[model samples]
Target chain A: MPNRQITIAELPTDTLEPRHFQLTETDMPKPGEGEVLLRVILMSIDAANRSWMRGATYRDAVKAGDGMPTYAICEVMESNSPRIAKGDIVAAEATWADYTVTKAHKVQKMPKVEPLSHLMSVYGIAGKTAFHGLMSIGNPLPGETVLVSAAAGSVGGYVGQIAKALGCRVVGIAGGAEKCKWVEDELGFDACVDYREGNLSKKLAAACPNGVDIYFDNVGGKILESALNFMNERGRVVCCGAISQYDTDTPTGPRNLPGVVVVKRLRMEGFIVMDFAHDDAKCVRAMQHWVSTGQIKVFEDIVDGLENAPKALIGLLAGDNKGKRLVRVGADPK
Target chain B: MPNRQITIAELPTDTLEPRHFQLTETDMPKPGEGEVLLRVILMSIDAANRSWMRGATYRDAVKAGDGMPTYAICEVMESNSPRIAKGDIVAAEATWADYTVTKAHKVQKMPKVEPLSHLMSVYGIAGKTAFHGLMSIGNPLPGETVLVSAAAGSVGGYVGQIAKALGCRVVGIAGGAEKCKWVEDELGFDACVDYREGNLSKKLAAACPNGVDIYFDNVGGKILESALNFMNERGRVVCCGAISQYDTDTPTGPRNLPGVVVVKRLRMEGFIVMDFAHDDAKCVRAMQHWVSTGQIKVFEDIVDGLENAPKALIGLLAGDNKGKRLVRVGADPK
Candidate 1:
């Protein structure tokens, strides 16, 4: 059988054009002694992909020309390790490819949960980023106001649900009415402010009358400014992502920041998820418990083909995806 | 004896003209119950006086025309309260006036650990401001590197000493050779960087090779930017005053801040000593202990007479004062 693989051919420019991705069919290699051949089932699409394309974010941190970064749902196609036998469902850091092989340590055993796609999503890096941002940086207490920007998306959805479950008054800020409704009614956010609506600052203030205590900032332009204005004294702002500013050639600084932090005594910290990679098991266990108890909801916006990965990623950045944007590559052998 | 009172007859614009202050000789009234007549000795001349003259800083948070705010060393001329008696030396809030009547509660019993002038100098607001900025906001831990701007001044002098006593590697930024040598030798700073000599960024980086863990910022602008650049991960910057920008009509913000805080997770907080009035006793007691043990040295630049108050304050803003700048309105009776 012919194996398939993906390669980083050309880097994307300022704008991530469709031509940036060069798809070529190549023969996949056999598994080493401790390796497992994974038949890629689903691949996640994230704003972080834009950084991978531009060759900026991970250039110095991680090696260059490392096969395009991705997280994928897979099945053990073949394995030398007894831990993951053929046909065992798993999740691994693969690529925008159909089949790939990695060491057993790299392959995580996806737990049997309510929704299988969640293993590649709400229980994935995106989810963990939000979880850590909330738990460690946020330190949200019961009855406190928890404000989340990009709140209808993957990490935002989980963040809202978790804060709600933790007894916080969760408020979300998204681009449209549909996203706002989903955040309020589906994820059970106490209120959702549509940032696209005129007078976002006033609307956000009205939505969070008591003022924001914990701000999970994903969009970091005007939304950040609005949240800063609404923050209560000694508020915590977790800078998990700056999706709004990520695409620009040059990022804009927070103008009102000095006054904001000074007047309110606020704490705003930016962090990478891998900083808390040591606490993976803790995050997974807590998320699993929440899933089993039905206290949290996981949503995946699945696109059915590996060929559509680039478009899916583009759509994800455009706020077109409703939840954890997933590109279905192949069938899960399980 | 005729009682004389001083009033802000006119507001100052660009400079302190004679009309800005009005002296009126009034009849000396009998001391009311629980009040004492304070024969003003030493008065604090601070840039905060400039703000007090403006009647506001950022907003109308601190209104102007509050009878010219000053912290003074005074002799109790007469007292009706049992706690305070005539001819006792004390520290109280007196204006730019020669004699002012204040309640016994408004006065603190002078500690004999230091000279009456030194106590009214370092142990007063200027010194307490430094202590609070270092311990509370800057939070310099043992063996950490602390960078203090305006090192030879009242606040910065105490900041270097406190940080040194706490086992920190202290670096000072001052204008001239005299100030720099005084900071390094007398204040016990590990090194002193002459900010007036050359490129502040390069100098600061060289001075703090290990990176700055805490920055006690009195001189804002370029010093702030330099301090921000050399900040280690999780560094804390305490903005007690922005003397570097105090003279300007509109203060300039540090442009390099976003890059600094985002990369190092640095926290910059502004504080006023009055905000900690609830725990003022704790601060005073600790300072008193430090003073008595010779662990901390107090510096005073005393200008004799009430008439020289304006010139002394102007000299303070011009960076003339060697230590805590005070105006001796009258001699200490004790």
Candidate 2:
């Protein structure tokens, strides 16, 4: 069978676009020793993917002609290792492709869930990222106010819902009025401010009257600056990602940093979800409980077909998707 | 006795100048109920003094025509409250004046050290600031690389020495070759980089080949940017003070903040010494031990007379002082 793959046509010097990616078809490869050949099911589309194209961050830098890296759920078509069965569903470092061949040890065997998309949403990177960044880094108290940016996006939507589940006053900052409304009404956030509307500092102040005790920052730049203005003394700024900066070459940072950080005695920390991989089992248990009890609502924005992966990422960068965005490459098992 | 006082003639819109202060003779302050009349012995000249004029920080904002506020070692003249006795040596919030009358309860009694300036330098705000910021915030481990800015200055000098005493590799960044030399030869830092020499990032990288484990930030701006680039994975940035930003209206922040902070998984925390006041006793015990064992060295730059207080501050901000800068206003008790 032919494997369709999306490769980087050229590195983006400024804002990322669909033109930066090129779709190519190649012959499917067989599994080598200690390796498994898998059919890519659902590929996670995140802002971090755009960041990887910028330069080396937590992971290796993506270069021109390189297959777009992604966290994907796949079904093993063939396995050379005794550790994995042929039909086993696993999550692994994948590319924007129809199939991938990777070492068996690198792939994580995933448990069967009713909605497979849940593994890409709530039970996967988005869910675990929101949980760890908020619970561990943010350290939100029961009555504390959590001000989260990119509220309508993947990790952010879950972050607000999780903060609400923890009995905190959750306020969200999304791009537009529609997203803001969805974040507040659907996600159960106490308030949602539209960053597209001017005077973010004043709006944030009005929304978070008690002041922000923890700022879960997903989209950095101006939003981070405005949030810093409303942060309470000794507040924690959970530096999750800077989606606002990832797409552009000329990224303006928060000008009030370190000065405001010093005056308010703020603790600004950053982490990758993989940093707490050891606690993934504990996280899944809690998330499962929250999901079953309906305390945490799962929102998945799934785009069909592997060909649309580039467009999905471009749209996601433009703040088009409402929740955890993913590209469904192949059919799910009956 | 006539009290010679230095008042802020006008607040500086940018860099502070000696002409911004006006010295005048005023009537000696008298002790009211629960108040004590203090003879100011030596007044601390800090970069934070200039920051106060910019706007309110941890302390109230210093306005035009207000007496320049200072932390000083004083001799109690008359005490209205039984909590403090006359003739006791104390550290209190005083000003650029020979006498100050403040609530007795606000004063902290001092021990009679051999060199009175030792109390101002090693055992006072400078020492405690270094201790609390590095030990608590930086959380320096032995054999770690600690990079401190303004190394020859008050707090930075102590910070480097304290880190050294804790068995860490300490590199300092100071302005000018003279200050950098003094920082290395006198203060005993592993290496001291001259920030004025341009290409700070390269210099810092060469100095800290193991990469910076903890960055003790004092002068925040370009130096902070340079330090951020050299920070190792999971490094800690101790946001002590932004003296660089304090003196100017158009203060530029580190452009690579939160981004570098995220990629490196760094923890950048800020603090005021008063936040750790409860543990001051414990810190003093540790510091005293370091001082007695010759693990910590004391360096004091005593600028004589109340008239020179303004000049001392201006010079200190301009990177003139090699250690803890102080202005002697009155004679110490015989």
Could you report the Cα RMSD, in angstroms, for every candidate shown? 4.5, 1.2
Writing each residue's lDDT as its tens digit, candidate 2 over A33-145 gives: 99999999999999889999888887899999999999899999999999999999999998999999999999999987867889999999999999999999999889999
In terms of TM-score, which candidate is strongest?
Answer: 2
Q: Clashes in model 2: which pairs?
A: none
Native contacts present in candidate 1, fraction: 0.15
Q: Clashing pairs in model 1?
A: B41-B329, B55-B64
Steric clash count of candidate 2: 0
Highest-lDDT candidate? 2
lDDT of 2 by residue, B1-334 (tens): 7888999998889888888999999888889999999999999999889888988877789999999889999999999999999899999998889899999999999998867788898888999999999999999999999999989989999999999998999999999998898899988999999989988888888999999999999988888888998999999999998888888888776768768888999999999999999999998999999988988888899999999998999998898888999999888788
Worst 10 residues of 1 chain A by lDDT: A55-64
lDDT for position B278 in model 2? 95
